[model samples]
Target: MRRILYAIAGTLSLITGLIGVVLPVLPTTPFLLLSAWCFARSNKRLHAWLINHKYFGPAINDWEKHKGIKASNKKRAYVLIVLSFSISIYVVPLTWVKVLLLFMCIALLWNMKRIKTL
Candidate 1:
């Protein structure tokens, strides 16, 4: 039962991670990390595959080893942050809400920037 649950979680995380590649609203690294964790619990083969994957393996391994993001990923994240803020500024009408959102955005950006990205 636990294995089955892990398998399901792994599959969902992988699907979400794939979708995140094209959709800026969905994050890629978090889902990939989730998938890796699930696979580790469910199947050794899958865990190995994810950790050794060509396109994503390096980022995942770096994150696992150092809790860091890659430089390219950091750049992409900054772009997304700007885009999201622009959208929120236009779409949200309430000044207080917008301010709150902006604060949250700044906090997240700061946190991401502080992480050791290579």
Candidate 2:
């Protein structure tokens, strides 16, 4: 039952992470990491496949090995966060929504800054 739950959670996280690739408001790495975690506990093969994935694998492995992200990836993430959030902020009509989005962006940026760069 525990393994089944983990597998379900892992699959959901993977799907969310994939969606995050297209939707900037959603985050990719954290969900991917969560999926990996769930998979590691539930299914070794799924974990191994995720660890070997072309685009996300390196980031996951780097985080696992060094507890940090690559400098280049970090920089790219920063750019994406700023650009996407900026666009969203500009497009949104509600003042409160804009303020909320701004705060969220700041929080995300701060969190990224706290992470060690590899």
* Global Cα RMSD, each model: 1.9, 0.9
lDDT of 1 at 54: 98
Candidate 2 lDDT tens digits, 24-77: 788899999999999999999999999999998999999888999999999999
Candidate 2 vs. true structure, TM-score? 0.95
**Every model's TM-score:** 0.82, 0.95
Steric clash pairs (candidate 2): none
Q: Output the lDDT of residue 44, model 2.
A: 98
Please give the distance, in angstroms, between residue 101's alpha carbon in candidate 2 and its true position after superposition: 1.2
What lDDT does each candidate get? 0.89, 0.96
Task: Identify the candidate with maximal lDDT.
Answer: 2
For model 1, how does the per-residue alpha-carbon lDDT over 10-67 read when each residue is reduced to its tens digit?
9999999999989876788889999998999999898899999999899889988888
